[model samples]
Target: MGCAHGKCCNRDSSTSDEHSGHHQRGIRPYKNKDGLTQRSLELVHVPSHNFTLQYSSLTQHGYYPDTTDRENQDSFCIKTQIQGNPNVHFFGVFDGHGQYGAHCSNFVKDKLVEILSSDPTLLDDPLKAYNSAFLATNSELRDSEIDDALSGTTAITVLVVGDTLYVANVGDSRAVIAVKDGDRILAEDLSVDQTPFRKDEYDRVKLFGARVLSVDQVEGLKDPDIQHWGDEESHGGDPPRLWVPNGMYPGTAFTRSVGDSTAEKIGVIAVPEISIVRLTPSHLFFVVASDGVFEFLSSQTVVNMATAKVSYTLDFNACLLQNNATAYKDPSDACTAIAGDSYKRWLELENRTDDITIIIVQIKGLSNQSVVGTTDSEVHSRPCQTGGSMNQSAAIVPPLMHQKPLESVGHSSCSFLSLYIYIYLSHLFFIHCATRLVDLPYTWFLCFATCVIFFIVVPAYIQPLGEESSYYLCFLMIFFSK
Candidate 1:
């Protein structure tokens, strides 16, 4: 692992002394004073002082070695209590590609935070700050001797300020949130993947006179007789890649990235799409990872794994009461498990593995202090839903048409339809209560009469119909439950 500015911060003096042996054994942080002056070390354990935050992060080397003598070209950083701002927290994962990518990622990891923290504007307009920081970092890299023409990194960063979360990304690295929705946990992508496949990216690069082509398309230029090609056809069906016309240099898969001066001439810019969402009681946890993990797994898979492996349990009543502390859970266990699983999955591939990095951040839930006394029977007494059965009182909506497993679909669609339905129904219920029942005069009585007929009277009228009338019963149950 490479450190920012070639220095790691050790919390314990004894640990620093212990690591001196490793330094002697040729595994020490470098003393690179060029470019960024700020220092950062890999695998530094940073705990929170203000909030109950438990997080874990890890990085692994890739299967193929680069000119830098290291296979991994990824870097990450976690900082809590930002400049004494207890509500402010930061998490970042940078995935580097090209020859000098390691140095590029490390440089950004060290300097970007320093620039954001020192600048006063970040507090007023976070989006502007994020944008400026990216441009500044890229500008610095261009002036530095790190060879931005041959090296660049994808940046995905999350800034949590009180209840607001601002995610900014300029590359394929992703940030996703796991939200609690009634009986199930839902996953929401906070950052957009800026690959050549995205229409906006493709258009932007085309405007800059760049050609998005596959290796097969470039090869087809040699054989004009080739009649037609599939949309995504490439070298063995590889994804279409960005390239500069008349040059075979900087064949990057992603459209937006930092410190790629060579690609910039051909329209690869570092502008990030900033995503903002408020942290609510329903918000569970979020994960920030490099493309290595996402290449093999979907966002929902990452969310499910993180939610299950998290050390804290989700408290239903606590969430309803808006007592996030009770629902809060630490993510150290989750992060560790995800890192191991990510590496394992990568190893399962036959050819090679990319650099794997994962950072799991707990959102609304605080870490569990300790288990006290016996487990609550009331909490554990609820019957879990079985795979084969649906509650008779509930609607009998048929299952999805496709019975194939998630693996069959390559995990592209992680069953987000269920999440969409839950959101849509909740929104409808709220809209009815707010616009119809509360504001309309005398309409409340009409609505009540309708509810009574649909829920109470209709159910009584159909109870004796038995299995033959299940479809109608389910229809009645939908309104009744609402």
Candidate 2:
């Protein structure tokens, strides 16, 4: 959200070896002012942009949270311009308090795209809007005393425009896009997992002189009785610690997030570094999911299942090829195969740590959907294979034939004018709310109303305003101009 600092463009430090991930357009790996590749990630498209889209989500209270402070949230969004319209279909998962399933139940509703397209500027500078939204929520919670010592959720949100998709995130929720390079990794990550894994997070702890721990370290810290207990009895070692602040582990945890105002003061909460990856033609399916799902399966494992051809509509759950121990769709029912399947679906009440949600997108045929319903829609005969291999047809690649048409896009340009105006006004109103400069319930109402007008009415002014309103005069001018 910060103005372009010309820092992400580390040309002098770029490494272009075929083995390196440098030289990716105007986008090279952006090291935070901290100088680290932990934030460096990439996005790629495969074959061509055409592809089919589908998604499913599930959640359960693993061990307990219906009464505890632990919270979890998992969400993902898929927007396809297949309808070839300006509107975008956005979705998100708002996993809440890890104690029970209560957190994520209504989160999806609260987590929708704020319909800001009405304000082109918000849409254009989504990063700023995103940061504003996060900080704004934190401010509100702190002011209202709504967030005391508990309650927060992790979020994973995705946006797809034409073939370009974007991800913005906070907390531990994650976004992983599959690349189509002969079954290789092509994910240009848009959201850095706000794990305590980064060095800055570690330094921040050191700043407060707090302790840190990966999930594994947490277990080790326990059971002081076991002197020098160096992984002798542990099977998989230790799980990564979810947190590393507040006088705990001294290394890493929590770089940025929401509802953690107290934690921020204590230096546990962090403002996430944003990552933007264009879901071009070369990119294949994208997996925007929660850690719950990851706990049950590896990312590539899910990709293998999702990309396998199926016989049911990729959007439905009944047709999903659950571990049927791994199988393919029947030839005739191929059209009805679920776009992606999940063995780790959230419906199971198995005790654990968090909620599970995932948005799976298939490439190649993803660009447009023409309502393939009714005929053979009920058929879901699983294919006869468990091989998690990429379907050659599902690979995506950005095409030169239909590039993002060139345009003179600038602040003064008509295309950008309306957007920035909307941004300025919306930003002004929120800045007031965020800073509590005019804080009040009444003021809240006013701010909300202003946001509505900016998105809904601004477009009209953008089109031919200031024209004289006279029947005869207008007709004469039109005639003369013609």
The models' CA-based lDDT, in order, is: 0.57, 0.37
Supply the global lDDT for candidate 2. Answer: 0.37
lDDT of 2 by residue, 362-456 (tens): 44454442222122222231211100000022323332233331111122223354444445554554555545636566777776775666455
Q: Tally clashing residue pairs in candidate 2.
A: 74
Query: Among these predicted structures, which one has the highest lDDT?
Result: 1
C-alpha RMSD between model 2 and the true structure:
24.0
Give the per-residue Cα lDDT of candidate 2 at 62. 28
Question: Model 2 Cα displacement at 119 (Å)?
Answer: 5.0
RMSD of 1: 18.2
On the 0 to 100 scale, the lDDT of residue 277 in model 2 is: 54
Q: Which ten residues in a row have the lowest lDDT in candidate 2?
A: 1-10
What is the per-residue lDDT of model 1 for residues 345-430, given as tens digits with 9 covering 90 to 100? Answer: 76675354566777776643433321112222222111111000010111112222352110111222213443344345444544
